[model samples]
Target: MKRRLLLVSNSTLHGGGYLQHCQQQIQDFFGKEVKRILFVPYALHDRDAYTKTARDKFKTLGLCLYHMDVEHTVTATVIFISDVLFFSLFPGYEVESVHETPDPVDAVRKAEGIFIGGGNTFRLLKALYDNKLVTEIKKRVLEDGIPYMGSSAGTNVSTISINTTNDMPIVYPPTFAAIGLVPFNINPHYLDPDPNSKHMGETREQRITQYHEELETPSVLGLREGSMLLVEGNKATLLGSTKARLFQRGKQTTEYEPGSDLSFLLTDAQ
Candidate 1:
């Protein structure tokens, strides 16, 4: 099956609610068929608390969030190996830790939709590798045609590698390799160079330049604030008012406008 993904640059815009910017587009992506959501809050520090807050956001869009098996009845049991999450029995529609589930991967596979929250990219990748859930999530989204959405650091993981991310490496993961759900990489929360800046720090563009020098094969897209990439089947379009920057190896970096044809941006990396 073709991949169905939504990569958001950022979840909240300043004073806006969590994911309030893309709520309409997000709801439209899953539509009415999606009843359950596999919320992966590994990126954030307090995943348990985040899960409760995340469930509330889903409720705002008139949707319930929970993960269940194929039988339609909630019966799977959870046992968390760490205190990161508390396990809960599948008594009814409720939010719990991903690792707490009996079969973490299987639960993800069975869910109608998957939601990955934004936080630290390194910590998130480490958690995924630790729990051996990287492959399971890939199988569910890429093969099963499940709807997936991620913002900021969450969006960075959707690509082949997290090399292009703007976050610091607070924790070292097994590898810089990510989900590889998308063919290329993304630098979310991309800040354009300011003409009046006199500070000595390198701009976002300059930093990405350093990244390109290291791995020139993988293309990187700089997703600015409030911008997102909505992928349907083979097509990936830029959704929002602002434009996005695209950096290709040995090619001049170009800016992609909103509503423009972005079907070719999803091509495989060289």
Candidate 2:
């Protein structure tokens, strides 16, 4: 699969506007060829507002944004509501919701670029599974050479599983299986044990280790805030000002400094 992805740890930094930090990088990632973007706003609750927020951001990158299939919606009178189980895309226009289409699969095949926003990993996975978009997304990003972008929970779903996510089990999904766009899992917003905090809680490392003990999950890249992963084909590079920590069972936990070649992390040691 020849995949191209820009998976970010978080959307905003302290006091930063939405996607303000990565706007240039995002523009570079998708390149000038992608003029339209098929947006997946499932990870958010207020889908319309979320799409609207992203629309402004994507406009900065010179990309027009369109959202996906769902039931119930946000309008003038209703503020917050959305449902799932469909997909749709058309030419030279935008759809209000999935009600416009009877066939969702064929619609996805025409996608050129896709973006998945961040919020709840479980909910995102559940929506993908319920709507049967998992395979279609994989086909688009992994096989069809569509450029994909995700942040936080969006990045979480790109991994092998969402078991390492910090979100609570607020809702039940059919399975913990994620889109597996990448070979391993990711622990976004991975915090190092605070050097000064007196609060005695399981550190993020310990939490991931415990998850590994039970699940024996694949390697996990602990993506700190302000960091991101840029993948082109089989090569994955760590970008930003900070180092990203890597965790694998029976292997030394290591922190890869920015600009360090991270393509090795995409494959196991020889």
lDDT score for residue 206 of model 1: 85
Best by TM-score: 1
Clash count for candidate 1 is: 0
Model 2 ranges with Cα > 4 A deviation: 62-104, 268-270
lDDT digits (tens) for residues 123-149 of candidate 2: 888887888888898888888889888
**What's the CA RMSD of model 1 in angstroms?**
10.5
lDDT of each: 0.78, 0.76
> Model 1: runs farther than 4 Å from truth?
63-100
Worst 10 contiguous positions by lDDT, candidate 2 = 81-90
Q: Put down candidate 1 lDDT per residue, 88-174, tens digits, no spaces.
A: 222222344575578777778678888788999999989888888788888888998898888888898888989988788999999
Number of the predicted model whose lDDT against the real structure is largest: 1
